[model samples]
Target chain A: MMLEILTYPDPRLKEPSTTVETFDEELRNFLSNLEETMRAGPGGVGIAAPQVGRFQRIAIVDVSSHKKVTKHHGRLVLINPEITDWDGFEIAREGCMSVPDYTGNVIRATHIKLTAQNENAEIKYFEMEGYEARAVQHELDHLDGLLFLDRLVSRRHDLFQRKTHQKKK
Target chain B: MKNWFMLALVGQDRVGIVAQITDALYRGGCNLGEASMLRLGTSFTMMMMVNTQLDENTLISVIQPTAEKLGLHLHLDQIEGELHPHPEPDVKIVVHGADRAGIVAQVTGELANAGLNILDLETGVGGSDKKPFYFMQIEGNATQGMEALQLALEKLKETLQGNIDINLSPLETFDL
Candidate 1:
């Protein structure tokens, strides 16, 4: 079943999710719903479980089919992921399904080396950059129950109209 | 507490728009606090923060008809509640260069190495092949004990080979 996308200011979006202790059928199903929800939302590249009314420590990211941007390819199911190291800073415009009708310019660690448990229950460390890295950081923030608004630049110059500034896509 | 309402109005530009809206506010017992208006082409846009603690319903009701009669699209909401200001300092950086490969990676790579938190950023490429302008605006805060902020910005300026300017300033807010 496709997950329902949550909009901004919904208290459920702010509740810290419980960690997934085991990779089982339920976890796999949650991951699939995440994929579906991400694809369903307008301009969505990643989504977390909390965004779909489930406060579970899980997120899924995929930027492969997003126009000319070449990012880390494939579906990334991050179950209790954590950043181990970062290599650079990249600033980009970010939008969220929960925060409808607004997008902000956010600075994020551009290159990240992190570890996460995938669907197969294998713990893996991966290094990602470009669009993929931005997507990962955004989704991970959702797992912590923090909306992008919480980390926004807190300045007018920090936000923008997404339609006028959309990158070549 | 002063319960102020922020109202935005958009409609064709002509005389009497302001007087009409303010007249309704006067009748409704709302006092204007802060206001700004501008003309966009044939349309005029106005925004005001009106104090209405005693009777919000009356203020909204009075202005609602004025807006309708004037063919204006009006929106009214309570002023944003008190928000704790972020204490960290901020800087704005602009990166511009040829639209080439790995420009963002090269610049952001330096930012990551320095442990700065990017608060906001936007990037785009324009112009033509002979003279392309890859522009980006980055707002970030530096980590403690890092090199001088200017020094770090200058270092990025040199590394990316893009014309860079860094401005350290307080937080900002404005309407479109």
Candidate 2:
């Protein structure tokens, strides 16, 4: 049962999801279908449970399926995932399946560790870097109702760039 | 449907500009949409997309006084359609080196040659006099990946002799 990927303006994408409390067949079926839906899309590496209209903390990311993911190594099905640590920063442009026709530079931690549950309700741990790290962050945003646009790094010049707009004396 | 208006304001940087403008618009019942405000050197610019039940003439009349009081130039144009995210084919182009002539033209010329369209280009020359620097950020699209245009910039930096550095990344869009 492959689920429909929710696009922007879909209220479901904005509503926050709850944690997955049980590791049962229904959850397994949803996870599997979510994985299928993600794999079937072009340039898709991950999908959150809420994306398919399931308001639960479940997401599947198989970076291995993306042409560029082969350069990295990791595939995950996460339930109630939490980031325990983060380090550094990388700003890169990102597009989302949920929000089409836009891509913006998002700041992501260069390194991160995540604690989550697999389909069996078993706890899984991940320490990853590079594209995989960004994929995880992007999927995690959905669980909390955040799109990359929410993390846009525009106007960074407010911090250090010379103020060319200063009034002349 | 409500009418859309684009308001552009540029003037010397100062406090209270946003407060005054927004307060007036809020009082007039204007719905503000996507907007960007930036300070460049001694100048400040703000561009906003707004929706309201007012006509362009009414908008200018309402905003013009604020512009006059602040000594800012204003341009307001009525537009149609709702504002949404835009994904143009572009790259994040960063060029930095010592200040000099023709840096912009040389780089933009290269981009033009590669068939790219620039959406936003910001150039600045600032730093200590002993080590003045030129910095630029060009948001543009060249029908190819960063690698494809590598030679265009590498050659320019080689010829310009500013010890120029260039970084390019594809402006990727995820269309579902």
Candidate 3:
């Protein structure tokens, strides 16, 4: 089941999500739907619960399908995710399903060590770098009621409007 | 119905320019839209879209006094058709080299020939007066795709004979 993604200016997208306390069947069910929604989106490699109007610290990431990314953890279901440590800095352009009209250059940590829970409520730790790290950071931001627009390095120099026409892969 | 106009102003760098202009527009019952305000060297420039019930003459009368007091050059033109033109850029091109003439013209000429539409561009000169460096970043849509645009840039770079460095990359976005 694919969940409906809320676009920008939807006040709920700005509302911070609470941590997931119970790891039960309901939580697992929602995670499955979130993964379906992410896969259904055009070029979407990750998604957070808040994007579907659910106020929970849950996100799904799977960058294995991305040709440029060689290092990825396949499909990761992160519940109550937290970045334990981060290092390095780089700027990359980012676009979100919520903010469909524009893309912006954002500075993010190049590497990050994070802790999250799997669908079975097992705590897991992972180290991510490069594009994978960037994707995780982007989804994590949604849990905190943040958007790429908030992290733009420079509004004038870094912000760009997305082209209306889609390019063929 | 809304009357849309493009307003342009340029003047020496000074404080309260925006405050004064906006205040006058507010008093004249004008609503502000998209705006770009920046400083170039010692001068400040502003380009804005304004919507109001006033005609050109009346609009000028409303902003004229503020413009005169600030010693700024002001121009107002009624907008026709689309208020916002040009799509977002799909590619980013960066050029760096020693200060020289024809860099912008030649580079942009190639892009134009390739049918790419330049959406935003900024150029600056740095380093000492003895050995100045020119840097430019351009965001545009490459209708012919990144490969074709990259080839065109490569050809342009060769034409310059290693005098300048040009880097072309796709402006990609991930849905996260």
DockQ of each: 0.02, 0.38, 0.42
Q: Kindly report the docking quality category of candidate 3.
A: acceptable
Report the Cα lDDT for residue B122, model 2.
Answer: 84
The global Cα lDDT (0 to 1) of model 3 is: 0.88
Looking at model 2, residue A64 earns an lDDT score of: 69
User: Which runs in model 3 stand beyond 4 Å of their true positions?
Assistant: A155-169, B80-86
Model 1 lDDT per residue over B1-176, tens place: 36878889999988999999999888887778657776766999998878765566666688989898888998878876332333232555666766778777777776667766786666776798688877776777766434655566678777655454434443321100
* B28-128 per-residue lDDT for model 3 (tens digits): 99999878999989999999999999989999999999999999999999985244443666788889999999999999998888877887898889889
**In candidate 1, what are the lDDT values of residues A92-168, reduced to their tens digit?**
55667787655655778878998988898789889998778888888888888887778767333344435576587
* Predicted structure 2: clash tally: 11
* Winning model by TM-score: 3
User: Per-residue lDDT of A131-166 in model 3, one digit per residue for the tens?
Assistant: 899999999999999999988887454435456797
Model 1 native-contact share: 0.00
| Runs of candidate 2 exceeding 4 Å displacement | A2-18, A40-42, A71-75, A144-146, A158-169, B1-5, B26-30, B51-55, B78-82, B144-148, B171-176
lDDT scores in order: 0.73, 0.80, 0.88
lDDT, residue A163, candidate 3:
61
